[model samples]
Target: MSSQRSSKTFLQLKYGEALDTAATKKSITSLLSSHDGTEVIHHCLKEGARWGMSPDSEEPNTLEAVYILSGKLKLHRPNEGSFLEAGDFLAGQPVSEFIVLTALEDSEFLYITSNPVFHYYSSDTRNLEMLAIEIEKKDGYTADHCFRIKELSMLVGEKMELNSESLQKLHFGALLHDIGKTEVPESILLKPAKLDEEEWTIMKEHTRYGATILRKTNITHFILAAEVVEQHHERYDGSGYPKGLRRDEICLEAAIVGLVDSYDAMTSERIYSKARSKESALTEIKQLRGIKYHPEVVDYFLSVIE
Candidate 1:
């Protein structure tokens, strides 16, 4: 008998030839199918492992989805490549009619394809309850802060009549604008004394650092959020950095974040500074309206606070 048939027969006899093989197979398939459509995929690919078609390989036109379950994978194209980590998703065309994948670690992934041309058996959500757990694991403080900022940003963004998509972006951007601060030195970040000029300079780099960190991820949807991080410190008249974007030169999203960020900073107690009264904070923001902040943004913030 053929080897495949012999193997099947062995399983059948072992489990009992009288048993329903089809039902057994169905149950197994159902268990494996549990990964379908979710970010977590179940396949183990170890580090330094390499697989791909040759340079002249005729690639198939297919819709592919990859989700990293654990560890990492480096997907290489002719001119570009990326490292994907757990929870990252990539849905795009293969590069140069060929592609290569190298595991960066012992990684698990869920890979799905619709093309019958290349047969390689190598691959890889949950509701809010699951999402909360996921976000907590990812970045707990930032996730919670973002949820609050999104609500506030939405109120301001909607008043501006931003399109639904732009409003959504603004909401998300506000929440993520300070995410880069994660990389800053904890001593500097939590310092109770005034930062020296050198310390201040280092602190300012958080914006650029934030943008760079997010740039390395597959979360292109957060690009605007990254930009907001980079520009939130910029002033209306001109004095901001890493870029001194002025007036309309700055993204509106950045302007919104700056306004709200200042409000939050003033109202929240810091080691170096006691929290100001709400009325005092509002007065200070109003004083800086046309000089340090965009007039329209200041107006909207004032309306919200009132």
Candidate 2:
């Protein structure tokens, strides 16, 4: 898609043509943009995928409208939910809260916003998504692992009744938590046996590496995610690695990710460990509630999974 601007009064876009494009698994293409921060974007989302919108300080007072092109979507706010189908339109002005859209089926829509989000969606967010792909390719067993963590973590976040901003941080942070493993050598990442003490040491560095990777983006959301990635390995009882942050020392977002990450790891088939049953994983997680995990986080997580 060409992002070139035309000095003419009008520009025509042909079928399937986009002015600019960005994506992870789902995609967003900028169809038009204005200097005043308005944008018309084409968004595609896989069934069950979620997208969040909130008015932040950088773009407060932003107004948005969604015109569903196909499939089904659900709009979720604090206490109410509404469903939209093809030809349905939803619009609202900026609010102090967040609104989330979940694709009930493979869905496409035209997202028009008064404030600019093209750069964040196109650049920073796209970069992070690409990094996730890189991690999947680097370790074969990690296919969709980060994505699953994100989904489950969000469930827990929602269950915990976290505020809008915290949910956003949790969403992005969970997806990028293992991004640091990209820096680890393939030998250790793919090794079918347990990592030796030295190899384990290298493995532990991924938390810091993930933090570094996210910090370089310089985006507030991802910067906060970096903190989650850095501390996700820290234990509630101060027995975990990197910083060994205990209990309240670990951010709630990291604690959420850490708990979900551990559960996902246990339930996933790995080169070093066989997949554990859901019941088994839950049993272990429940046992370590206050020791390996935060007590509040464990309660909410159990509620989400159950």
Candidate 3:
């Protein structure tokens, strides 16, 4: 549809007519941004198509109904991907970071937008950094430790060659991995000796608490990062924490953060343990392989360090 014609503002849009011009990219890119008073739109796509959209930061509130008229689509945002089939419908101010739409097969969809239920701040890292500073205050070492993990996790992610969206989520998630520990008692967190089973239980609860905080923020980016926060402790062989989720059940970003976190903890001094040589930590992690860490993540991590 021609932008000039579409701009005429007709009461009705005929077939093949689009309220907003079709935005295309080699893969994914931003499709829309802030505009004047309530404007509803319709988009149509053919097979092998992809589109990404972001809401206005100043007015983050938006309610939308998207119906997949035909074919299949993979909607990716931040750390999650949603598969929409023909007849599937999604509603709400449902965008964070951005919405990625990819046609798995020949596809077409219709969307209607309206006022949103509530407004939320757009993506920002400064707020999260301040929160991290506060959470890390309890332990002098962790401030630097978390940053190291973040660097290594992103390095691993880059080795794996993740897309920008995946890398962003991985970076933030790795930095916030231990944020949940803030909720636990310092007695258990700062103990110089091994934690008793009871104290260990409280330590384990950090994942749940951390994810809860991210979810409560209602910010798309952090909300997307919550998967890593909650699942970083889960093991590849179904043996790790708050949940025993195994294999692909764990989010890849979370697994990467977990592996890096473990690697950093081993190499860095902590109140409860002596620092191990980098070589030793690498050897120990290599031994765990698929048993403790995701095999692909381990391999990529090794390549990154090597």
lDDT rank order: 2, 3, 1
Q: Kindly list the per-residue Cα lDDT of model 1 for residues 220-253, writing each as its tens digit.
A: 2344346776888899999888788899999887
Evaluated with TM-score, which candidate comes out highest? 2
Off by over 4 Å in 1: 1-146
Instruction: Return the number of clashes found in candidate 3.
Output: 0
TM-score of 1: 0.55
For model 2, the run of ten residues with the poorest summed lDDT:
6-15
Rank order (by TM-score, best first): 2, 3, 1
Regions of model 2 farther than 4 Å from truth: 1-37, 42-49, 54-111, 114-120
* Clash pairs for candidate 2: none
Residue 203 in candidate 2 has what lDDT?
92
Pairs clashing within candidate 3: none
Q: lDDT tens digits, residues 143-181, model 3?
A: 556666776886687557565467556766887777787
lDDT of 2: 0.72
